[model samples]
Target: MAPRANPTLRQRRLGAELRRMREQVGFGGSELGRLVGMSPAQVTQMEAGKIGISVERLRTIAATCMCVNEPLVAALSDIITEREKPGWWEEYRGTLSEDFVDVAEFEGQARRLTTYSMAFIPGLLQTGSYSSAVFAQTFPPLPRHEIDLRTAFRMQRQRVVRSGTTPYAAFIHEAALRMQFSGPTVLAEQLGALIEDSEQSSVSIRVVPFDVSAMPSSSGTFTYAEGPIPELDAAQVDTSLGCRIFDAPAHVARFRSLLARFESRALSEEESRDFIGSVMKEMESKRA
Candidate 1:
């Protein structure tokens, strides 16, 4: 009834671009509605990307927005094609957070990903037990079913590495390494896994040492992803309410700055490898 209640990134993008173009033309929503032979509310919904427009109608709207250039049309066509394709994550609906699904879908299509985590290891590097521990801490009273579902969702998301098509880079704070979520054994196992994952040629892991007090990203974790097309980049900052996604150049630039600052303080790959091994050894010492 509500147009299937789902839209692909491509569809969403095409709809967003069209909405932006419409607003740029100085036509009031009502006026545009009059022009497009739709109601003012419908025009607003269309511009807000709550619904889709047929190709012919989209072209007409583009013409009205004065963005009828061939290149613009070509980009729209590309988005449509992408939207028409079925995504792999669609089957996991109702089980994962909408934010999780959105992030995963975007990551799947992304060509590159950069993330900074000061409190915990980025989700990509988290082991199943580590993830479960983190989630438990967040929703300590959640039902077992919900916890299992969330953990499973996270593991499924980790399949990004298994995909072997796109690669990502992660930077974490040394504090994250020291923060023991589970008992020593679980923490030790997860730390060991991080070292193994870092061995992959495509992924890069760096750690900002505890002494680096001036590093950025002290507020919370955030991620930036670049799709195959530069124009498709999206930045996400985590918040207690949920994730806030930023596509504007200004926001993305700020996140990039945070990453650069953290990178400046982070240990080199070899140094981090040593640090990881050392942490594992410490866990072993505790066992002994």
Candidate 2:
């Protein structure tokens, strides 16, 4: 598949650029709001991508930014004029959280992905049985239809992973391997899938062993996605307030520091495979 395109931040940056240019011309957001005939808070939201812009507003923004070129005006217009949402996610909109859809598109467009999983194996690497069993236990008395939908969505996520173009690095906790997603058979298949996935030249899978004594990820799962522009890239975490996106350079830098600590503590792909294989064998021994 071609690289996925995520324009959300791009639109925000364009708006921010307009704000900065207006400021450079010595106009505050309120002053620019006067020029655009919109409220200051609306200008702020425009710069933040919380709202879209109309053609009249686009023209006003271009004028306020002292932009004379038709191309610049059209480019910003394109951001708003383009109505088509990515096909992969549109159908699932009502079923999934906004963050979930946003991440899917972001991952599609991302050139690099670094992930850490302390709980169960990260959903991106989960096999169907692992996904189904995880969700089954998650929501009590989950309807069969919901279970099926989640399983399908998870499998679709793995498609790009399997294509091997997106460079993915994962540091998974040792406990995730021992945590039974299903019976021994289901877990055996999941482990085997992880081993197989780790062999891909573009994908790196690491395990943080219990014996490691400590790892940076006692916190929670986080994903750091890299993009063409540094500021446009992001580090995402599911915080107490729920999933939040951090694109600010400092926040992203902090995540980088944490990830470095994690990667350094994790086992290499070969070692991780060996560790999981051992666990699988131990499970078999128990069954025997």
Candidate 3:
């Protein structure tokens, strides 16, 4: 088969796992190639995500490498089986950055989601007008069409939270509550929407008040997506360039710990709802 010119995040992840397994067993590329009836170059290409691996081949590789993690192997097999399926984000593939599409893929496949935001409401919880307003503030001033496209993409991504099946937990800082992205009116509407969403049994919204004596030095926003198996979990963080996804065990663990810290410092769900109501009232009072 011809090598893939560009592989998606999931494809890359499968390749990484295969490479990790081989390394753990102390088998060099040429050595594994001989055992698997492939050339060393073929093994390298598969491990680099440039070439695909069949489920049978994957099983053979796992057996050769002495991997005993049945659950992880099954999860990897599922990924391979779903390789031909296209997600909703495919509609915007050429129009938007691949990173944007990857983020949507990550969120859509997750069993549960946890997010922490310090300066803005989590994208999944943002309302239409609020999201448009946030996009309008892009550093280089995006074209009107580009802004609209981004807003539409973001609104579409909220479906996972709206499905009412996937458990979602968001910890947003008090500072974000007062940012007034578009204005007090839009911010008020956004906060009101948050309260309504929090009413869902599967949704949890917690506010981290400014009064908290200590906050982590890392100010960036991040999301943790729980996979079927702990080893397959992924964490995503936004940077100036774009979203970065981390699936390595160590990175995922650190993100999990960071989210725990955020949760610990945030208000309870009920208290958060009351706090948000008060903020909405403050916004309304300002309008008066």
RMSD (CA, Å), candidate 1 to true, equals 2.7
Cα deviation of 198 in candidate 2 (Å)? 0.7
Clashing pairs in 1: none
Instruction: Show the colliding residue pairs in model 3.
Output: none
Pairs that collide, model 2: none
Number of the candidate with higher TM-score, 1 or 2: 1
Index of the highest-lDDT prediction: 3
Candidate 2 worst ten-residue window by lDDT: 1-10
Runs of candidate 2 with Cα error greater than 4 angstroms are: 1-28, 34-42, 48-85, 239-242
lDDT of each: 0.76, 0.76, 0.91
Model 1 lDDT on a 0 to 1 scale: 0.76
Instruction: Write the number of the candidate with greater TM-score, choosing between 1 and 3.
Output: 3
RMSD of 3: 1.5
2 or 3: which has the higher TM-score?
3
Q: What's the number of clashes in each of the models? A: 0, 0, 0
Q: Which lDDT tens digits does candidate 3 get at residues 106-220? A: 9988999999988899999999999999999989999999989999999999999998778999998998899987889899999999999999998999999989877776636
Report the Cα lDDT for candidate 2. 0.76
TM-score of every candidate relative to the true structure: 0.87, 0.78, 0.95
